[model samples]
Target: MARFIVRAIFAALGLWLASRVVPGVRVDDTGSLILAAVLLGLVNAVVRPVVFLLTFPVTLLTLGLFLLVVNAAMIGLVALLLSGFHVDGLLAGIVAAIITGFTSWVAGMVIGDAKRD
Candidate 1:
């Protein structure tokens, strides 16, 4: 419960960072940004696994590079679904995805270990 909230906050921060760092990726307002972030997290959790599984062969063929495209698609999907969040093009989506992913990874590191069973 608390862990999920924390992860969502981190994901929001990552999206905020992406908006700042990636040109053509824009959030109309702070509230919209946060909403987009939450939606992005939900989309990733719900849809990403299926997409990943279906693309496993392409992922392998590309030597893991296709993950970048998958990430970009996820970002693009968020932009399409969110009214106030906009990603201009594929390049913008890719850059925003990279920034968001890197920010999330760094945040995870800083947040340290998750609770173990």
Candidate 2:
């Protein structure tokens, strides 16, 4: 639970960074940004695998690059669900995915899989 919250905070940071750097990605405010982060985490957990499985053929054909589209789609889905979060186009979503992906990678390194009792 604590780990999840920490990761969500990091995800919010990435989203905030994306909003600032990407012209087409707009987050209305801090509240919306936080909501987007939590919503993104849920969407990625519940929806991404199914979408990935469904699009595996295209993803394979693209030599795995299409996963970027998949990731972007997940972000776009979050945007669709939230009024305050907006991704203007596929290009912006893709860029946001890159930023968020990097953030998650760093987060994973910081918060490893080791368990403590």
Index of the highest-TM-score prediction? 2
Give the TM-score of each candidate: 0.90, 0.95
TM-score of candidate 2 to 2 decimals: 0.95
Query: Candidate 1 regions off by >4 Å?
Result: 113-117
C-alpha lDDT score of every prediction, in listed order: 0.85, 0.95
Candidate 1 local lDDT, residue 109: 77
Compute the lDDT of residue 106 as modeled in candidate 2: 85
Best by lDDT: 2
TM-score of 1: 0.90
Local accuracy of candidate 2 as per-residue lDDT tens digits, 25-80:
99998999999999999999999999999999999999999999999999999999
Across 29-109, the per-residue lDDT of candidate 1 in tens digits comes to: 989888888888888999999999999999999999899889889988998998999988988888888888887787677
